[model samples]
Target: MTTSRLEDLDEANLSPAQKVIYDQILSGPRGIVEGPLRVWLKSPKLADKAQALGAFCRYDTNLPPRLSELAIITTGAVWRAGFEWAVHAPIAIKAGVSPQIAEAIRLGQEPQFEAEDEAAVYAFSRELHENRGVSDATYQRCVAALGEEVTVELVGILGYYTFISMTINAFHVPLPAGASDPFPAK
Candidate 1:
Protein backbone atom coordinates (compact mmCIF):
# COMPACT_ATOMS: atom_id res chain seq x y z
CA MET A 1 0.00 0.00 0.00
CA THR A 2 1.18 3.55 -0.72
CA THR A 3 1.65 5.78 2.28
CA SER A 4 0.73 9.37 1.59
CA ARG A 5 2.78 11.89 3.49
CA LEU A 6 -0.20 14.21 3.90
CA GLU A 7 -3.66 13.41 5.21
CA ASP A 8 -6.38 13.71 2.63
CA LEU A 9 -8.58 16.67 3.52
CA ASP A 10 -12.29 16.09 3.67
CA GLU A 11 -14.18 18.40 1.35
CA ALA A 12 -17.11 18.86 3.74
CA ASN A 13 -14.94 20.10 6.57
CA LEU A 14 -12.91 22.54 4.51
CA SER A 15 -12.25 26.04 5.83
CA PRO A 16 -13.97 28.85 3.94
CA ALA A 17 -10.83 29.70 2.01
CA GLN A 18 -10.22 26.09 1.12
CA LYS A 19 -13.85 25.72 0.18
CA VAL A 20 -13.65 28.60 -2.27
CA ILE A 21 -10.65 27.22 -4.11
CA TYR A 22 -12.05 23.73 -3.94
CA ASP A 23 -15.27 24.94 -5.49
CA GLN A 24 -13.35 26.86 -8.13
CA ILE A 25 -11.40 23.76 -9.07
CA LEU A 26 -14.53 21.67 -9.21
CA SER A 27 -16.19 24.17 -11.52
CA GLY A 28 -13.17 24.82 -13.70
CA PRO A 29 -11.99 22.83 -16.67
CA ARG A 30 -10.57 20.17 -14.36
CA GLY A 31 -14.03 19.51 -12.87
CA ILE A 32 -12.51 17.46 -10.03
CA VAL A 33 -9.83 17.87 -7.43
CA GLU A 34 -7.36 15.01 -7.55
CA GLY A 35 -3.63 14.34 -7.49
CA PRO A 36 -1.41 17.26 -6.49
CA LEU A 37 -4.26 19.73 -6.34
CA ARG A 38 -5.64 17.75 -3.42
CA VAL A 39 -2.27 18.05 -1.74
CA TRP A 40 -2.07 21.75 -2.56
CA LEU A 41 -5.49 22.29 -1.04
CA LYS A 42 -3.84 22.02 2.35
CA SER A 43 -2.76 25.59 1.70
CA PRO A 44 -5.68 27.31 0.08
CA LYS A 45 -3.64 30.26 -1.21
CA LEU A 46 -1.18 28.02 -2.97
CA ALA A 47 -3.99 25.90 -4.27
CA ASP A 48 -5.79 28.94 -5.68
CA LYS A 49 -2.84 30.33 -7.63
CA ALA A 50 -1.36 27.02 -8.67
CA GLN A 51 -4.66 25.67 -9.89
CA ALA A 52 -5.26 28.74 -12.04
CA LEU A 53 -1.82 28.49 -13.65
CA GLY A 54 -2.36 24.75 -14.01
CA ALA A 55 -5.67 25.28 -15.75
CA PHE A 56 -4.08 27.58 -18.29
CA CYS A 57 -1.08 25.37 -18.83
CA ARG A 58 -3.28 22.33 -19.16
CA TYR A 59 -6.37 23.49 -21.00
CA ASP A 60 -5.46 26.77 -22.73
CA THR A 61 -1.88 26.29 -23.88
CA ASN A 62 -0.93 26.90 -27.49
CA LEU A 63 0.65 23.50 -27.79
CA PRO A 64 -1.81 20.83 -28.71
CA PRO A 65 -2.79 18.24 -26.14
CA ARG A 66 -0.54 15.73 -27.86
CA LEU A 67 2.62 17.75 -27.37
CA SER A 68 1.68 19.14 -23.96
CA GLU A 69 0.92 15.66 -22.69
CA LEU A 70 4.24 14.51 -24.11
CA ALA A 71 6.09 17.16 -22.11
CA ILE A 72 4.07 16.29 -18.98
CA ILE A 73 4.87 12.57 -19.12
CA THR A 74 8.49 13.33 -19.82
CA THR A 75 8.65 15.44 -16.65
CA GLY A 76 6.91 12.67 -14.71
CA ALA A 77 9.40 10.15 -16.07
CA VAL A 78 12.33 12.31 -15.05
CA TRP A 79 10.98 12.83 -11.55
CA ARG A 80 9.87 9.22 -11.13
CA ALA A 81 6.51 10.58 -10.02
CA GLY A 82 4.21 7.59 -10.33
CA PHE A 83 0.99 9.51 -9.93
CA GLU A 84 1.95 12.00 -12.61
CA TRP A 85 3.02 9.29 -15.00
CA ALA A 86 0.03 7.05 -14.42
CA VAL A 87 -2.36 9.93 -14.98
CA HIS A 88 -0.77 11.62 -17.98
CA ALA A 89 0.71 8.73 -19.94
CA PRO A 90 -2.66 7.51 -21.13
CA ILE A 91 -3.70 11.06 -21.94
CA ALA A 92 -0.50 11.45 -23.91
CA ILE A 93 -1.27 8.34 -25.94
CA LYS A 94 -4.92 9.20 -26.37
CA ALA A 95 -3.88 12.64 -27.64
CA GLY A 96 -1.93 10.97 -30.46
CA VAL A 97 1.52 10.23 -29.04
CA SER A 98 2.70 6.82 -30.14
CA PRO A 99 2.59 4.04 -27.56
CA GLN A 100 6.13 3.16 -28.51
CA ILE A 101 7.20 6.71 -27.61
CA ALA A 102 5.43 6.62 -24.28
CA GLU A 103 6.93 3.21 -23.50
CA ALA A 104 10.40 4.48 -24.26
CA ILE A 105 9.88 7.44 -21.91
CA ARG A 106 8.53 5.10 -19.24
CA LEU A 107 11.78 3.13 -19.47
CA GLY A 108 14.01 6.26 -19.66
CA GLN A 109 15.11 5.46 -23.19
CA GLU A 110 15.10 7.58 -26.31
CA PRO A 111 12.00 7.16 -28.43
CA GLN A 112 12.01 6.78 -32.20
CA PHE A 113 9.35 9.11 -33.50
CA GLU A 114 7.26 8.89 -36.66
CA ALA A 115 6.54 12.63 -36.71
CA GLU A 116 8.88 15.56 -36.75
CA ASP A 117 6.81 17.51 -34.24
CA GLU A 118 6.76 14.59 -31.83
CA ALA A 119 10.50 14.19 -32.19
CA ALA A 120 11.00 17.90 -31.51
CA VAL A 121 8.80 17.85 -28.41
CA TYR A 122 10.44 14.70 -27.03
CA ALA A 123 13.88 16.13 -27.60
CA PHE A 124 12.99 19.44 -25.96
CA SER A 125 11.39 17.87 -22.89
CA ARG A 126 14.08 15.20 -22.50
CA GLU A 127 16.93 17.63 -22.83
CA LEU A 128 15.32 20.18 -20.56
CA HIS A 129 14.88 17.61 -17.81
CA GLU A 130 18.04 15.55 -18.28
CA ASN A 131 20.45 18.41 -18.87
CA ARG A 132 18.55 21.06 -16.92
CA GLY A 133 18.91 23.22 -20.04
CA VAL A 134 18.21 22.80 -23.69
CA SER A 135 21.11 23.02 -26.09
CA ASP A 136 20.95 25.69 -28.76
CA ALA A 137 20.39 23.09 -31.44
CA THR A 138 17.56 21.43 -29.56
CA TYR A 139 15.94 24.76 -28.76
CA GLN A 140 16.23 25.90 -32.34
CA ARG A 141 14.85 22.63 -33.59
CA CYS A 142 11.92 22.81 -31.21
CA VAL A 143 11.21 26.41 -32.05
CA ALA A 144 11.42 25.65 -35.75
CA ALA A 145 9.03 22.77 -35.56
CA LEU A 146 6.66 24.20 -32.97
CA GLY A 147 7.07 27.99 -33.41
CA GLU A 148 8.04 30.50 -30.72
CA GLU A 149 4.59 30.74 -29.15
CA VAL A 150 4.12 27.01 -28.99
CA THR A 151 7.65 26.53 -27.75
CA VAL A 152 7.06 29.03 -24.98
CA GLU A 153 3.90 27.17 -24.03
CA LEU A 154 5.85 23.95 -24.18
CA VAL A 155 8.26 25.38 -21.63
CA GLY A 156 5.33 26.47 -19.51
CA ILE A 157 3.86 22.99 -19.69
CA LEU A 158 7.18 21.50 -18.70
CA GLY A 159 7.56 23.90 -15.78
CA TYR A 160 4.01 23.33 -14.57
CA TYR A 161 4.33 19.55 -14.70
CA THR A 162 7.64 19.78 -12.97
CA PHE A 163 5.75 21.43 -10.12
CA ILE A 164 3.15 18.69 -10.25
CA SER A 165 5.81 16.01 -10.24
CA MET A 166 7.47 17.52 -7.20
CA THR A 167 4.15 17.68 -5.39
CA ILE A 168 3.23 14.10 -6.20
CA ASN A 169 6.64 12.73 -5.34
CA ALA A 170 7.32 14.79 -2.23
CA PHE A 171 3.83 14.28 -0.81
CA HIS A 172 3.66 10.60 -1.77
CA VAL A 173 0.43 11.15 -3.62
CA PRO A 174 -1.17 7.79 -4.25
CA LEU A 175 -2.17 6.61 -7.67
CA PRO A 176 -5.84 6.05 -8.38
CA ALA A 177 -7.41 2.84 -7.16
CA GLY A 178 -6.48 -0.22 -9.23
CA ALA A 179 -3.77 1.69 -11.09
CA SER A 180 -0.40 -0.05 -11.06
CA ASP A 181 2.70 1.94 -10.25
CA PRO A 182 4.18 3.34 -13.43
CA PHE A 183 7.86 3.03 -12.58
CA PRO A 184 9.59 -0.12 -11.42
CA ALA A 185 11.90 -0.15 -8.43
CA LYS A 186 15.18 1.42 -9.42
Candidate 2:
Protein backbone atom coordinates (compact mmCIF):
# COMPACT_ATOMS: atom_id res chain seq x y z
CA MET A 1 0.00 0.00 0.00
CA THR A 2 1.18 3.49 -0.81
CA THR A 3 1.58 6.12 1.90
CA SER A 4 1.53 9.90 1.61
CA ARG A 5 4.83 11.70 1.91
CA LEU A 6 3.05 14.34 3.99
CA GLU A 7 0.90 13.38 6.91
CA ASP A 8 -2.70 14.52 6.94
CA LEU A 9 -3.41 17.39 9.32
CA ASP A 10 -5.60 17.01 12.33
CA GLU A 11 -8.44 19.50 12.51
CA ALA A 12 -8.13 19.86 16.27
CA ASN A 13 -4.46 20.76 16.05
CA LEU A 14 -4.80 23.34 13.26
CA SER A 15 -3.15 26.69 13.76
CA PRO A 16 -5.41 29.74 13.61
CA ALA A 17 -4.26 30.58 10.08
CA GLN A 18 -4.76 27.01 8.99
CA LYS A 19 -8.18 26.96 10.60
CA VAL A 20 -9.17 30.10 8.73
CA ILE A 21 -8.16 28.63 5.38
CA TYR A 22 -9.84 25.37 6.28
CA ASP A 23 -13.02 27.23 7.16
CA GLN A 24 -13.02 29.07 3.86
CA ILE A 25 -12.65 25.80 2.03
CA LEU A 26 -15.47 24.33 4.02
CA SER A 27 -17.83 27.18 3.19
CA GLY A 28 -16.90 27.14 -0.47
CA PRO A 29 -18.60 25.03 -3.09
CA ARG A 30 -16.43 22.05 -2.24
CA GLY A 31 -17.49 22.16 1.41
CA ILE A 32 -14.60 19.87 2.32
CA VAL A 33 -10.89 20.24 2.82
CA GLU A 34 -9.45 17.14 1.16
CA GLY A 35 -7.16 16.17 -1.69
CA PRO A 36 -4.40 18.67 -2.51
CA LEU A 37 -5.93 21.21 -0.19
CA ARG A 38 -4.82 19.00 2.67
CA VAL A 39 -1.28 19.23 1.37
CA TRP A 40 -1.42 22.90 0.46
CA LEU A 41 -2.73 23.79 3.89
CA LYS A 42 0.75 23.22 5.21
CA SER A 43 1.60 26.60 3.64
CA PRO A 44 -1.43 28.64 4.46
CA LYS A 45 -0.50 31.65 2.36
CA LEU A 46 0.15 29.46 -0.64
CA ALA A 47 -3.01 27.56 0.12
CA ASP A 48 -5.00 30.79 0.19
CA LYS A 49 -3.68 31.93 -3.17
CA ALA A 50 -3.80 28.55 -4.89
CA GLN A 51 -7.24 27.68 -3.54
CA ALA A 52 -8.62 31.00 -4.75
CA LEU A 53 -7.42 30.30 -8.28
CA GLY A 54 -8.64 26.75 -7.96
CA ALA A 55 -12.10 27.90 -6.87
CA PHE A 56 -12.43 30.08 -9.93
CA CYS A 57 -11.13 27.48 -12.32
CA ARG A 58 -13.35 24.79 -10.79
CA TYR A 59 -16.55 26.54 -9.83
CA ASP A 60 -16.69 29.80 -11.76
CA THR A 61 -15.27 28.81 -15.13
CA ASN A 62 -17.52 29.30 -18.15
CA LEU A 63 -16.75 25.81 -19.38
CA PRO A 64 -19.61 23.52 -18.50
CA PRO A 65 -18.85 20.86 -15.92
CA ARG A 66 -18.79 18.21 -18.63
CA LEU A 67 -16.03 19.92 -20.56
CA SER A 68 -14.20 21.14 -17.47
CA GLU A 69 -14.18 17.70 -15.90
CA LEU A 70 -13.13 16.21 -19.20
CA ALA A 71 -10.04 18.42 -19.27
CA ILE A 72 -9.35 17.56 -15.63
CA ILE A 73 -9.49 13.79 -16.06
CA THR A 74 -7.37 14.04 -19.19
CA THR A 75 -4.78 15.96 -17.21
CA GLY A 76 -4.97 13.33 -14.47
CA ALA A 77 -4.37 10.59 -16.99
CA VAL A 78 -1.38 12.35 -18.46
CA TRP A 79 0.15 12.84 -15.04
CA ARG A 80 -0.94 9.43 -13.79
CA ALA A 81 -2.39 11.33 -10.85
CA GLY A 82 -4.31 8.55 -9.18
CA PHE A 83 -5.92 10.80 -6.56
CA GLU A 84 -7.14 13.21 -9.19
CA TRP A 85 -8.70 10.49 -11.31
CA ALA A 86 -10.36 8.94 -8.26
CA VAL A 87 -11.99 12.24 -7.33
CA HIS A 88 -13.05 13.51 -10.74
CA ALA A 89 -14.03 10.47 -12.78
CA PRO A 90 -17.48 10.17 -11.21
CA ILE A 91 -17.97 13.90 -11.46
CA ALA A 92 -17.11 13.80 -15.14
CA ILE A 93 -19.62 11.05 -15.72
CA LYS A 94 -22.36 12.76 -13.70
CA ALA A 95 -21.75 15.83 -15.82
CA GLY A 96 -22.37 13.77 -18.98
CA VAL A 97 -19.03 12.34 -20.05
CA SER A 98 -19.55 8.69 -20.87
CA PRO A 99 -18.04 5.95 -18.70
CA GLN A 100 -16.38 4.59 -21.82
CA ILE A 101 -14.73 7.94 -22.42
CA ALA A 102 -13.47 8.22 -18.83
CA GLU A 103 -12.17 4.64 -18.94
CA ALA A 104 -10.37 5.27 -22.21
CA ILE A 105 -8.66 8.32 -20.73
CA ARG A 106 -7.61 6.31 -17.63
CA LEU A 107 -5.98 3.80 -19.97
CA GLY A 108 -4.34 6.46 -22.18
CA GLN A 109 -6.36 5.50 -25.24
CA GLU A 110 -8.55 7.57 -27.51
CA PRO A 111 -12.23 7.37 -26.74
CA GLN A 112 -14.96 7.24 -29.37
CA PHE A 113 -16.94 10.42 -28.78
CA GLU A 114 -20.51 10.86 -29.95
CA ALA A 115 -20.56 14.62 -29.56
CA GLU A 116 -18.53 17.03 -31.64
CA ASP A 117 -17.71 19.19 -28.63
CA GLU A 118 -16.56 16.20 -26.59
CA ALA A 119 -14.29 15.12 -29.43
CA ALA A 120 -12.87 18.59 -29.74
CA VAL A 121 -12.27 18.82 -26.00
CA TYR A 122 -10.50 15.45 -25.81
CA ALA A 123 -8.34 16.29 -28.80
CA PHE A 124 -7.41 19.71 -27.50
CA SER A 125 -6.65 18.39 -24.01
CA ARG A 126 -4.65 15.43 -25.31
CA GLU A 127 -2.67 17.64 -27.65
CA LEU A 128 -1.98 20.24 -25.00
CA HIS A 129 -0.85 17.64 -22.47
CA GLU A 130 1.20 15.48 -24.85
CA ASN A 131 2.56 18.22 -27.09
CA ARG A 132 2.73 20.95 -24.42
CA GLY A 133 0.56 23.14 -26.62
CA VAL A 134 -2.19 22.78 -29.16
CA SER A 135 -1.44 23.29 -32.84
CA ASP A 136 -3.44 25.74 -34.92
CA ALA A 137 -5.62 22.97 -36.32
CA THR A 138 -6.55 21.67 -32.91
CA TYR A 139 -7.07 25.18 -31.53
CA GLN A 140 -9.36 26.06 -34.39
CA ARG A 141 -11.32 22.87 -33.89
CA CYS A 142 -11.80 23.75 -30.22
CA VAL A 143 -12.85 27.31 -30.87
CA ALA A 144 -15.23 26.26 -33.61
CA ALA A 145 -16.90 23.63 -31.50
CA LEU A 146 -16.80 25.37 -28.10
CA GLY A 147 -16.42 29.04 -28.95
CA GLU A 148 -13.51 31.25 -27.93
CA GLU A 149 -14.71 31.96 -24.38
CA VAL A 150 -15.44 28.39 -23.43
CA THR A 151 -12.26 27.24 -25.11
CA VAL A 152 -10.30 29.68 -23.00
CA GLU A 153 -12.01 28.34 -19.90
CA LEU A 154 -11.04 24.87 -20.99
CA VAL A 155 -7.40 25.96 -21.01
CA GLY A 156 -7.75 27.35 -17.52
CA ILE A 157 -9.25 24.09 -16.31
CA LEU A 158 -6.46 22.10 -17.90
CA GLY A 159 -3.80 24.36 -16.44
CA TYR A 160 -5.29 24.34 -12.94
CA TYR A 161 -5.62 20.57 -12.87
CA THR A 162 -2.09 20.27 -14.12
CA PHE A 163 -1.02 22.08 -10.99
CA ILE A 164 -3.20 19.85 -8.86
CA SER A 165 -1.77 16.77 -10.50
CA MET A 166 1.72 17.98 -9.79
CA THR A 167 0.89 18.47 -6.13
CA ILE A 168 -0.68 15.03 -5.83
CA ASN A 169 2.22 13.30 -7.51
CA ALA A 170 4.97 15.25 -5.80
CA PHE A 171 3.48 14.76 -2.37
CA HIS A 172 2.75 11.08 -2.88
CA VAL A 173 -0.88 11.63 -1.94
CA PRO A 174 -2.52 8.26 -1.50
CA LEU A 175 -5.91 7.24 -2.78
CA PRO A 176 -8.83 7.61 -0.38
CA ALA A 177 -9.75 4.52 1.59
CA GLY A 178 -11.55 1.88 -0.44
CA ALA A 179 -10.65 3.65 -3.69
CA SER A 180 -8.44 1.78 -6.14
CA ASP A 181 -5.74 3.50 -8.12
CA PRO A 182 -7.37 4.56 -11.35
CA PHE A 183 -4.32 3.48 -13.31
CA PRO A 184 -3.42 -0.02 -12.25
CA ALA A 185 -0.42 -2.05 -13.43
CA LYS A 186 -0.86 -3.13 -17.01
lDDT of each: 0.92, 0.92
Write candidate 1's Cα lDDT for 1-186 as tens digits: 269999999988999999999999999998989999999999999999999999999999888899889889989999999998888999999999889999999999989998899899989998888899999999999999999999998998999999999999889899987889988685
lDDT of 1 at 66: 90
Residue pairs clashing in model 2 are none
Q: Which ten residues in a row have the lowest lDDT in candidate 1?
A: 177-186
Q: Candidate 2 residues 18-103, lDDT tens each?
A: 99999999999999899899999999999999999999999998878998898899999999999999999999999999999999
TM-scores, each model vs. reference:
0.97, 0.96
